[model samples]
Target: MAIPGYDSGNVAEFALERAGARAEVVAGVVPDEFGLERSGRDPTATALADAVEFVGLEELRAVDAFRIELVYDPSALPPGASPTDVGIAVETDDGWERLESTVDLEATTVSATLGGRPSGSTIVAIYDGTGES
Candidate 1:
């Protein structure tokens, strides 16, 4: 079995939110799991901890195993939200939407905001298009 690592939500959930399909979500990052953000919540922190990866299934000799890692910015959460149980949201063409009921998160991280309550991370959204960016 192939191995994988992540800091947040899993693959199936993330994809469904993106594709507007159906999926189920669980908690914690499993050793072998992928990740996704349903693009929901008014001020969620899934963006920082969010990550997406796609390897040509054909390259692994038709292997069906994959992995995803998440690392979210804790500040994005509400004032009294629980850091342990993180929520996910997806942004679509129309507007911010919620992933199906099956969506869930994997791992999480929280850091004190600089003279502020809490804010979402800009690492993913402002990526410079380095292809790797």
Candidate 2:
């Protein structure tokens, strides 16, 4: 099966693998920004575009529930910015809801559990206290 409008090279391949399906690129590519690059100098180099569109991955839709995990490096954040300063919001039929979060600074990840979400709810994560978005 061929999927249209996805990255042509590694991104599509990776999405296919993650989807656990065999799919070919039928049209348009997923673009380089969607793929990871190890340029020798930066072995951990990865660029996740601000947004990505995935098609034909019904398996992903099977997720009954999910947790939002925001990972950040303390050193990368502005001085004096605490991990608790961040928060996540999920779009509901009525409006946005703030999720109760757990902060794990050692792991540099903040997690918030969101029960089952609507099919196409937008999740917005922001620096709630004081910092950049």
The candidate scoring highest on lDDT is 2
Report the Cα RMSD per candidate: 15.2, 12.8
lDDT by residue (66-119, candidate 1, tens digit) is: 322234555665466554443233344454333211112333422111121112
TM-score winner: 2
When summed lDDT is taken over every stretch of 10 residues in candidate 1, the lowest stretch is: 110-119
Candidate 2: list runs displaced more than 4 Å. Answer: 1-64, 89-98, 118-125, 130-133
TM-score of 1: 0.28
Clashing pairs in 2: 6-29, 6-30, 7-29, 7-30, 8-29, 8-30
Candidate 1 clashes: the total is 26
Cα lDDT computed for each candidate against the true fold: 0.30, 0.37
TM per prediction: 0.28, 0.39
